[model samples]
Target: MASPPVILLLVSLLFCIATQRLYAEQAPNYTFVKEASEVSPLQGRFDYIIVGGGTAGCPLAATLSSRYRVLVLERGGVPYGNSNITRLENFPRTIADDRPDSPAQRFVSTDGVISSRARVLGGSSCLNAGFYSRASPEYVAHLGWNGTLVNESYPWVEAVVANVPIVQQWQSGVRNGLLEVGILPYNGQTFDHIVGTKVGGSIFDAEGNRHTAADLLEYANPDNITVLLHANVHRVLFRTRGRNQPLAYGVAYTDNTGSTHRAYLERNTRQSEIILCAGALGTPQLMMLSGIGPAEHLRSFNISVLVDNPGVGAGMADNPMNAIFVPSPTPVETDLIQVVGITPFGSFIEAASGLSGYAGATSNSDDFEPYLGIMSPQIGQLATYPPGERTQERIAEAVAQLKVAVAANNPAALGGGFILEKVFGPLSNGNLRLLTTNVSDNPAVTFNYFADPADLQACVQGIQTIEQVINSGSFTDFRYPQTSTAFLLNLTSSLPINYIPKHTNDSTSLEQFCRDTVTTIWHYHGGSQVGRVVSPTYHVLGVDALRIIDGSTWNFSPGTNPQATVMMLGRYMGVEILREREQS
Candidate 1:
């Protein structure tokens, strides 16, 4: 019944798949590439299809393929010979670096508020600092989740992949040390002896060098899991007996060459389930395209609503940490080092979690506070306004003041003495929306930070505290303006407010002077929550045989690198799925 042209196209595509399979076996760890000049239709199917094989997807694919036939669909090509991924030593910030940008950068634009995650096979982890921490037990307990910690979730993750630790001991930089001085006031005891007082533990003593799930994927058995590079998942193909409900059958996608088609397994092949580990942004975007989100929003976008789950794209939460930069008296060679966190007894109660205490115990040091990198979670609220609203503008204004304070303190940013204290969020309660019915089109991401005065207030206090430490301790040996004086001067000066830095007096401005200079460290969460977006079983509320397991499924942001948590989730989900399939 097929037309001559269609039959010819199918024949050509089949030949390409056979050829690639042959090459894949020969170079198991390398990219099996067809030149950009080769045109071929993407037509293939597997029992389980995972889109975006990054942090969560890679682990899930490796785990699930242990038994069932699994196919991972990735938008970016494999980095076979790319120096960025291969060079384990250079873990610098991926922004503007030659490394392939992650999907998280997709949402970001010239304006700071809207940002996107990475879109490669290894996802954002491909571009991240390789910081690893198991999600604290508190985050799961608060959400009534049973398994989300290092012991429960991490061990399995570690078994399949490596959680590389710091190879050697390193000391905190001047900025972090100075910031620690400010929190000392909250503790009456000597800062050194107080458990959970000073942040440490960035030290890793030559434990197995940590590697990513991508590394495992290449080294794992090739016969079971087939990674189709340069393949983009366009949509989930659904079939319904009538109009009552739709059953997910297969997927439709386009290869690098631009030919598109629908694919399904042979006549009798059956899959017990399909797991969606496409990550926070991609998972929800795929769901929206598949008609599995808020009915009203779907209708607005002309996307047919498959399951009317109002919480599908709601409850987006992120950490808004303020960075405290301190000038060092002398420059020293250093890699990544841990800066301790000090929290008052009342502060822990205020944050509504006991993680401060737990983290202190696990690290075997009295400084039982959190350690922050760009990925560390700091508590602040900026949600006093809605996304793209007035509150965000106010935050931008506050950030501008903060930038001027730094410029005044350090005339040359290129010097090692200059530290950038970045405050991440006064989190905005934003949601992910489908920009178009097509899954490939980027979705709209708006984190409406600075919506609440409380969010700004918390950060304001953090800066004030950090400033006090620098002015009082051995830090006083250096020249810098007191936050109080700087803030007071800003109050007196009738300065025009803007998001750009300007000249300001170092001695006269108050702490409030440097407020609006904070920006997001790219920590995103909650758009696709556990109880809200998916059921406790990790399945789409009304859709059978489909579940979401990734960072987006997080109930609350844990205030740190989500890589460990996301990887753990994939491992747990894969085991659960396989177990259930075996029982059935």
Candidate 2:
């Protein structure tokens, strides 16, 4: 009925709409300098060189690139299109992958605590559980940071990667359980730190796609920033002028092809700086390698001490966790740390449901039996005995039963596991020391978990609190009826021998249990404490043109998950660096 011209216009509009939809659905094509050869004849100078293009490094580089030539050297590959890094459902598999170059780099501490650190461009933010929360106001003030500036800076990173979590059924149950146990009136969905049950922000979006810190680079001035992946910085290169303190002028790094490359600061500008955002483990390790650790420790390795900052790799702390795995008879939708219970006792009890089960194992040889046993403190005690001894008998029995359950594809046994993690705040002590002069070798990491009696007591109390939540009326229907692995085939089984808490109310048994089962929540901090290794302004003490702006500089771990604090610190540092540059 329309005129010929009108008909043509209608067809054109349809074509445009379809084209736009197609474009919107298409994945982003990221251009990365993955090979050393790609940066042929690497530039001799950059205004700022950020080591470790990680959670902090990415945002810092993005901010600095607005006015300066910034270089970000990441030891790992890019996360673009990597399923393990982008998909929420792939959480466990990603961290469990043992490949040296995988996004997750698994390492065991000297105390037998097993964990992993991120190796990808986004670092641990890309591999972590994706929970996000702001640092407690008290914690922010403790650092003597400009509280006003910090509050202003949080939104810059939050706008890019943070999201209000989508609460599913399991998370809802957790919320109700916490309230029933008197965690207090619900704080609801919020990003601020409060003492109550609340749903905080997550890096994973509503569709279950993960948005990592690397995504913040979209705000960067690409023309001024060059991000090079697989660029492993071995040490900071320093220049000493007329007996002045050693000034960081450049860095020596290895590329993807194992070729050594050097990138230096422009001699013309005193504003040029080498910033270490390489995280708690990497930053201190790099400093020590550059002759900036305890004088005696460096001397023992025959490495010249650059600064003799004894605090460079001291006073490390990690949030130790004790978890309870609850299985379900029905399939539950996958979820993560959506609802958190902040207790008045300085402990955090969080519950997550719907992780993939044993049936999803990538290999037949994959042994999940160790994971089940490892989550308990009893396993650590069993390790002291020889393989066939009585101490090992209970575990062996539990493992056999678990294997049988897995083989039978029991809905109650195969899938639908919920984890209740009790993350304690700032009370434990640990340290990282160089094992070898070689940068590739992992440092000797020792988390003397629960070494302090107070920490042990807190963990024991935390476990008791978690049990209270689990036993609450809200979780009655969702709770797994089976308790004994030995008779798991029996539909009405009580508590599995493996699932039993070593001692329900006995402090000694609980303390022993904590020793065996406690592992890091991965909230590591203070390897280079503020005012110890670095000034409160975040510059390294007794050094020139060097700053640390990552978890390493935190005086103590925040009272909650530290990703939000890490990002906030990155933004705060970026602003400080900018201010300093303007003054210079």
Candidate 3:
């Protein structure tokens, strides 16, 4: 029944997916990459030593490798061919996995919200929902970036690690629902960080395979890049000059075998450097460890101070998020944040559906053999370690249940999805500090969600917008109601915010909803700002030949998702570094 043009498009897409999968499997073999243990001396000199081979680090290393000998030291293993990260449907499990070797590192902030950061070579780009939107024009100008160079850098990142997503059944419905709520006139599809409803780009390909920043390493001259995995950098080595600021010379890192190794920039290499792309949390933590932070704080850890600066881990901020879960009438296709509703009140609405079970194989007493329980016709439950549950049996039961539910046209029987809102430009801020001298341990951070009254007001507005979308005609088919009226998601407040009349006695209830349900979108930034801790060129202040390039540099998050700008930043700076050297 389909038209020829539509059918031909589908065929072409399928072919493209198949080709990408084959290309991934047949990726280039780089003889330069090795486990830290494989390298004998474990000490060398390079033109640049970049710590943390993450979303930004990989691209920066690849670009710099074209002109200089570059070394990238990643504390985690590779993400290639990892099913947990590659498959779009396995997102929940990937975020919930908490093992020591897992690519996702789970941590709870002092503010009491659960979050995760990437420990894989591709960095958080490997762990995120794969959304790709550039920084707003306002943000680019605010940072004093070269507008021409910034524009030129984006396509390079997109060509290797991004794609135009195929908007499907669930996403299409959400997009309509967003428009119905009066979020704006639809902007159709775009990768720009604009104001309106739009289908954003993704790092995931048509085949449900994730192409991470690690894939950008293909652009590197393999002969010039020496990447070492399982390399945990401890501190930056510095050489002090008489009555002058110290100069960073190298780094000391521990390998998988608990043996330490030192890698450095040659003493005579002109304008050589050490770069930290260890992310917001890791970069500031490393600076403090290297005795470059608050004098009293570094003294507490028995680290002798080289340069005292209290700004190392100040101004920590994360966008607070709230959500509602709605079950659908039919199976929704697997997707993550394909459509977004950019609100006028500094909030962004997004959704993801069909995430699988959340069970991680951790060596804890709580590890359980989970089973699906049909508690009632309308409800399903997860069992914790029910005697001896087999993986095959669990799969069989799930498939059988799904088939029956679909045949019966039972909306309540199907798995539900989530609609979430995250407030932008959060005024609230917190700080990050070390618990011990161990650089390997997760540091203590507190992102004071909704600490500012202004942020709470924005959250109230965003939630009200979501209420309109839920009550809209476009979303009616997605919900199964028990009554002719309506039912609201209970977010564990005094009552669901929508249940009360809009002209209620007090607006205090809506503010209460913001505090009680505060969560994270994991878009945290600003431990090291450009003006405070680093120069406009990302060079660390008061330290020679050291630079920091990552999400930590920004006081304001670039876009709804920060990965696109972060990746672009790396490439932009890399080109600048090469151009400076060439001109000189």
Candidate 4:
């Protein structure tokens, strides 16, 4: 089952040498990478074409590159060197940014929840808390995937990016708090999504740096992979044979310059494929945009129906998050999610501290919103000092030294953390529909969280469970404004902690709290369910030479965060495709 040690070592060295060759094209730096503007019309087609260079796209492209020429078209720019993406502390700043070039693109779901999606090369992985957990064995069996292959696929991704986080004080307290609430046996430091409370992996490293899906490109044979940035794919081109289903042959996309370019599969090879690794939102929207959704919906947009599959934009699910802000009198360490409690009630409990990196006490001050700009306000504050404290030259020196945000850790410096519960197995689901012909515009979607009575009861259970944890001995000391007999519970707003909904009143129940405070944990899935929109093997139904391999194709969102499984699916599909080709 294994190759000899010497042979394995030799193969590894050869791969290293090949990688060097790719990055070595410094004179034409990023020879394998180019802005869509720099790339001319394709003189040659590729063996495989991947759309969306985010979380799944990059890995899928890399795995295919080992044996086939692959092309990746990404709408957003590269993620390298972008501080908002590379630095752990800038996560809040990154997500808050809504500028045209911002890596995180903001979109409000029809559910009235504001959320953001990944718009950079690494996709949402660059913007998320970087929590990495594999889907449970149950999830794999439910999807009917090859269990062995799924396990094999994850290790490669983890080796590339996952890290054992240095669980700091705040996260430790949260872990203890979870145990106090009786979430059950603590499974320490594992990446598996099991039935107990556990500390999982993250993409953020010990040095507080991030490694995104883009990093997985190192596994590719660079000579066989071409990546184009700022390439927004508009539609998939199809060719129909007489009395046969239509086949995908190519894609048309636009560059930043507004010029359109087309890339196609290699001529005369039925093996060639055009895969959609775009996330849930993008994948389904693209199908509809390319005329593969419900006939009535496509007809409304003047798009000719190719497949008329109503399932393309149906069954949208988002894990609803109910969270509370916990303030600490004593300083707590800055951190993102580390420990998670997998409750038997179909909820996952987690926490994050020190976001926004404020160096003062946490407050309800309206002025706190200014930190949303993050660096600018602090940099401006750096300029104001007593005459003796800093002369103009001294200010300049201080400013230069502080430019890298060396002090931005421990948002708990403001003295708090966020304890959040995300509902798993949410019964409520919704749909996605086109708003405009523009591919860049967000298609309207509604997750309809808590639409089902069971879902609301689950959220209420999670809230009541958190109340017990807060009242527990392990976390009681962390509650700030200790002046009260207990908590400063407002008549209108009570339970858990501070800054709750103003609409909550004396008679408000935990169910009311669940509805009033619901937000997104960003693990969106469905819209293209297996056995509806695609084959179990990921091929798009009613079409040939096309596949959809992202969270969009999932029947349910798996694990605490879906990034790990999304990245794994990319690798799993690539290996399966290659294996099938070899066998053929």
Candidate 5:
């Protein structure tokens, strides 16, 4: 044995080595600036300026930073230390919080459909249901994307945040029920596109910690990337010459301190570009603000039209979700989405549990007022327009009536249970338009949920399919004695209301119930669609040095949860951008 003094010294050296390694792992390697002043004089130019440090933005920035000097400006704060955001149990709180700066910014549509978008650095990936699935192979082919590149890029994202979910008792039953209902032959657990009931990946790891796209920044080149949080880019700066197409050279943004800043691309470099990774709403809003939208709409707001592109904010689509709250006699395990039922009829069914307590405890009317206060101005404007005027008025009136109905009863809160959401794929009629010139103002969004008629029929079928699954033998023991809608209405029957009862088994009643309660499952896409708003290469039409790579770029909604597809597209764009620069 060595002497005591020698042993002590050796132990000390080992401890020091371990300490350094621990610090290295814990400390972030990339340059993260919280304020604009921190990075001022702002470096004047960057090889790439990516707005919206979101699901697509984070990975895109990471990939580009490997070979280029990149700047990522995010409107929300970093996601590292937010407790409500990090914990799975607090998922509802994060989405329900009405504060203006909440991680999930809630909004009610022109048609009174309520939904939200992620306002954190990782975008919706930070606020979503954590379900992860790739776009169907048909969707991939529809976009005509480079299939080999897409296949290779998915692993890069999966390696960072994807995990095999722990299938609890409730989830296992869901899987069986899905199969029994003719949703498949079970495809088993997979990340691939299979036309059957399957278990998909999740962003939540084994410990239930959410790994967001922001985590992918760990792969970034520390020396080449600068991520600035709360840096909201309001518009893309454009330079125009007498009749030639406009060129985007920079962006104007406001930092957390309300200080304005501008970042530009170098004049001589063809490689420099400004990419918008802002989600469906933000991306199109920015395009219209920067003068790239409908000429008449832009002119109404006194915005100088740069491109006269009518398609910038058109064709918005969302998964119209109808809920069935099955009250469990015993508390079910608190979980996010695990098992998914993909119907051949273009609607996808997924189940989530442990939110019944929250849903029951909160009265809709009490929550409706504040949410409406933020949205009323926009909806009020839509009510002034033609074609949708009557529909908008009815929605506003329904919300107003619900406020009156819930306040008097103050319904008893239900215990923890499950919620089933039915997501429908792309319908071509939804739209988003600027309500005002201000970038901070929420845009007017209309999902046109049931306008397609075929979409409405699909939803009606989907609701029936889920009811079948819940009523199946697999869920016999766990089944609620009453239908979910009946339990929901029982919690609120203070008056002799004229509306239909929740337990009405007829197709007409179910269809009516769907129309009354239909809201977004929060999968919003296609404001800046590929081949219309932007080229297939992800570059904006009628403008040089500008690109958009986010949900807004999708021509239509993916058949499954869109975050995985969005990330894959981001990775593809980042790789293609680099390749293009090299070729140029």
Candidate 6:
């Protein structure tokens, strides 16, 4: 039996969902000319021409089309109801695929570094962790922006997209214990009251699917957005009027057939603009190809210099992460998508709640600010030992407890069970550099991890915290044994600082073990930055009508997810462009 209020609420929610789905499923008023050949070469020039259909490009097109004739060019195919877009059900399994649908999934650039950008119509949004994290207050203030976390940005992003948490039922017991014992003690206010904590574990859509940009931007009236997939842009064609003055006319692009063509927005008859929403990699590549970068570099590439913006591509960073492993107690049966974990103060809760005043928090999206972890009966008792040996003891105890729990729950495993592990955490600084002048080449990326000692310390703290939680007597008769991801791999001395020269079979130091075993979470950012490459208006310095509006333009990599910020800029910049038009 359920309370009347609860039942009514459920009914209303279901109704709203059904209506929204129905609205999305209906075809737009205009019949889309799917084939490129259908639209004549001069099908009346549009009011706005946007390149790249990833994070910023998609939303920009959607918003601009509200009042203007907008055309969005995408180098990849469209992604809708495609398993390739929403296939990331498990966190561990998300990284197994090489062909992620986002920009970051692409080949290495000229710099010999892996450039992760998707060629699909949905861009990298089709290939991401599906984890949502908002920009922090401290971060906004540091960037010299006046907008509060609860006021301007987060709320705006929530309105247009779905960012609910995906919970995993079976892994709650184990995850909760880790939060209670390990993370809470050290991080004090860092993880408390964040958005990621709402759902006890990972959350899924009502249909049990991962949420993505494609999922969010599926508003009615698809006629406004014509996603031209497999249409890669080679350059932005500009006409020169004077010695120093240049006018942006249209863009030159290549279709899937490798044939070059051009498209333009209205110039004099209508107030129009060109938005370079081609993401970090594509934006700069387009600029350089259009001769809008450092004069020296452009000359090297044999490109005619248009705007000599020295900061076109520089200042790169990313989020580095480490993993923690645990053994399950029982035969877990629920989804293990993503478990919520918390700290003490306003950390996880605040993110979930949308800063302090609930500015970005919305009722329509799944509220996942509280349930941040997973647990199971399989997590048993603690094992005690000497200071250095405590790690081993705890591992053994957890393993034994899980064996018994699994046998009791399934009886088919004969006391044998699987082990659980966490993959990522916070990051340190890293960088990306231009490998060559060729746009076809990949850039050289250097993670430069452990370059800062704090990263290593965080990892050590993470390990110690896990040990403390398992040993805190939260579970019953458990035999905590000891085996570490660091120790088992014999990666002791490979850390940035503790690289000691040793012969084969040399013993590993404790510090070496910690460093060698850890890996990256793979959230790269900031190849081009504000106050460095582009201005606050997102205009690349010295360019007549060029702007960069993606995660790469961020001054600092955001603490949480980057999609909302990227999308917000698309909306905000679109307004800026409109305002510029109004004044002119």
Q: Count the backbone clashes (under 3 Å) in each candidate.
A: 59, 8, 1, 3, 0, 79
Candidate with better lDDT, 1 vs 3:
3
Q: Which lDDT tens digits does candidate 5 get at residues 1-584?
A: 89999999999978865653353234344565455656665865789999999989999999999998899999887666665566555465566554667777766677765567778888888877798999878888888888899999999999988999999867777788889989997999998867789999999876566778988888888888888877888989988977378888899998767888898887778778999999999999999999999999999999999989899998888777765555455445667788888888877777776422222345442433311211122223112223223243554564454445445542222233444556556563578998877777789998777777777777778777777877888876556565554544332222111122334333345566666656566788888987789988888999888999898877567757888988887788899988988887
The local distance difference test score of each candidate is 0.51, 0.73, 0.77, 0.77, 0.73, 0.49
The segments of candidate 4 whose C-alpha lies over 4 angstroms from its true place after superposition are 1-30, 241-243, 355-414, 481-502
Which candidate, 4 or 5, would have the higher TM-score against the true structure?
4
What would the per-residue lDDT of candidate 6 be over residues 1-584, giving only the tens digit for each residue? Answer: 89999999999988866754554344334333143434436466777778877777776676676667777777765554354344332222222223323333434322222224566655665655444445556666676654642345445555645444433323344355555554443222221125333332111354434444444345413655565666677788887866365667788876656567789868764356577777656676677778876788778767889877776666545443333333333323323223344333211211110000011222223321111111111111112222223243454454344344333553222211111222132344444445575444555555555555655665555444444544544422221245344442232222221122333234654345444443323355665578767787666665456567787777555544566566656666666666677788
Write one digit per residue (lDDT tens) for candidate 1, span 5-60.
99999999787656543432333343422332232443455677676677788877
Clash count for candidate 5 is 0
**What TM-score does model 2 achieve against the real structure?**
0.84
Predicted candidate 4: what Cα RMSD to the true structure?
Answer: 9.6
The number of the candidate with the highest TM-score is 3
Return the candidate ranking by lDDT, descending: 4, 3, 5, 2, 1, 6
Q: How much is the lDDT of residue 299 in candidate 6?
A: 88
| Candidate 1 overall lDDT versus native | 0.51
After superposing candidate 2, which stretches have Cα over 4 Å from the reference? 1-34, 355-414, 481-508
TM-score, cand. 4 vs. native: 0.85
lDDT of 4: 0.77
TM per model?
A: 0.69, 0.84, 0.85, 0.85, 0.83, 0.69
lDDT by residue (tens digit), candidate 3, 1-584: 99999999999988976765564454347666788877857565899999999999999999999989999999998876566677664554555455677787766688766567788888998888889999988899999999999999999999998899999877887889999878887988898888889999999887777888888898999879999998999999999957378999999998989999899897886689999999989999999999998899999989999888899999999988776556665556657888899888898988876522323322122332221111111111121212123133553455455445544655443544667788998899999999988887889998888889889888888877777776677877666645121233442232221112223223346576667656676788989888889999999999899999999998878888889999999999999888878887
Off by over 4 Å in 1: 1-44, 85-93, 97-104, 109-111, 114-116, 144-152, 159-210, 265-271, 327-329, 334-337, 340-411, 417-427, 468-515
In model 6, which regions exceed 4 Å deviation?
Answer: 1-42, 90-104, 107-115, 144-153, 169-171, 182-203, 220-224, 243-245, 269-271, 327-329, 333-441, 466-519, 579-584
Task: Indicate the residue-level lDDT of 348 in model 1.
Answer: 13
List clashing residue pairs in candidate 5.
Answer: none
Candidate 4 lDDT, 1-584, residue by residue in tens: 56699899989878855543343222223468789888978769999999999899988999999999999999998777676677666566576556677787767787766667888888999888889999999999998889999999999999999999998777787789888878889999999988778999999887667888988888889799999999999999999867489989999999989999999999877799999988989999999999999999999999999998999989999888877666566566667788899988888888877534332223333223223121222222213342224343554454344333324533223355667789987789999999998899999999887889888988888877766776677886676534231232231133211122336465566777777667677788888889889998989999999998899987678888889998998899889999999998
Candidate 6 TM-score versus the reference: 0.69
- Screening candidate 4 with a backbone cut-off below 3 angstroms (N, C-alpha, C), the clashing residue pairs are 354-411, 354-412, 412-415
**Model 3, runs deviating above 4 Å:** 1-28, 42-44, 355-413, 481-487, 491-508
Candidate 5 global lDDT:
0.73
